[model samples]
Target: MKLSAFADVCLRTLMLLGSRPDQLITTREIAEQIGVPYNHVAKAVLELRNRQAIEVTRGRYGGSQISARGLQLAVGTLMRDLDVRDDVVDCVSETGVACPLIAQCTLRGALRRAREAFYAELDLLRIEDLTGPASRRLLPFPVLR
Candidate 1:
């Protein structure tokens, strides 16, 4: 189960925000820090805001901040929002009329199990869990300003 680039961005953003719960981060800074396009960061931030995972503040000191619910929502929302097919066979398109062995293939089952395991691991973690001590140390400073 491959996660989308947007999901990666969202998670990274959330982790950064969660690490420093006291500070708001600008989209530009986030983009710079993550080495991603500014538009991509802005889009992800909007998506997260829509999902209520983050709040957007607009003003002289406006920026993005993570909410408690956002931390909780981030755990499984990305995987849930991802476009994943349950049938591995359906995901493959070939000249042949699909693999006949697909119905009996353990590969599909294994893939499903692996996907479930991946989500299960994600479910066990929260945004706060991903933040390191370094992030905590950085939290006190108003870096976004």
Candidate 2:
């Protein structure tokens, strides 16, 4: 199943924050480091703040940092919460038409299970896991893991 761009941004933001737990990062800095737009990072920051996954401070010299809750949060749980996209299969036809077999198609159910399984696999790891040496390398900045 494809994740929404919003979800992708949230994950990326989380990864960056997790990488440098001691530093408070601004949206612009996060955008620059993650190679995403400032607006996008701002939006992600707002949502993450709302979710209490990260703490935000507003003012000059204000920024955000990962919350204690964030580090222990399961990756799959966060993904599931942030991944509020449509079903994996809309079972629809081209030209904005709905498929006729939607009523009885088992394919939709199967695909749903597949998506759940994917999240289940992700449940094995937490945000802390993503801040390891390898993942730290993925970040644009140097980090001590």
Candidate 3:
């Protein structure tokens, strides 16, 4: 299952934060390092903060950091938190209509299982796991303001 753009940003932001662990990264800094728009990263940061995955401070010297609570979380659990959608497929039409084939379609069932499998595999990993040496090397360090 392909994660939503929002979820992607959330994961990338967390991964970047996890790499540093101690540094409080600003939203703009996260966007620049991850190649995402600051606005998008800001929104993702707010959501993550609300979920307690990250902590945000206001005013001068304020920025975001992954919470100790965040460190122990499974990647899949966070992904699920960020990905609020219940189904991999819409099973609905764009014009406010439900798919007529919803009842008889075996494809949806198969897709559901596949999606669950994808997340299940991700469940094997924690946010801290992504911050290990090998993965950290792939992430860019935050630049000074």
Order candidates by lDDT, high to low.
Answer: 3, 2, 1
Predicted structure with the largest lDDT when compared to the true one: 3
Candidate 2 to truth, TM: 0.89
The better-scoring model by lDDT among 2 and 3 is 3
TM-score-better candidate, 2 vs 3: 2
Expressed as tens digits, the lDDT of each residue in 1-145 for candidate 3 is 6788898888888899998889998998899998888888899999999989899988788899999988878989878767777777888888989999888999888987888788899999999998889988787734322
What lDDT tens digits, residue by residue, belong to model 2 across residues 55-83?
99889988999998888889888889887
Q: Which stretches of candidate 2 lie over 4 Å from their true place?
A: 93-96, 141-145
Cα deviation of 74, candidate 2, in Å = 1.1
Candidate 2 CA-lDDT value: 0.85
lDDT of 3 at 67: 95
Model 3: per-residue Cα lDDT at residue 40: 87
Relative to the true structure, how large is the alpha-carbon lDDT of every model? Answer: 0.73, 0.85, 0.86
- Write model 1 residue lDDT over 38-79, tens digit each, in one string: 888899899889988889999888999988887666466466
Sorting all predicted structures by TM-score, with the top scorer first, yields: 2, 3, 1
Q: Compute each candidate's TM-score over C-alphas.
A: 0.77, 0.89, 0.88
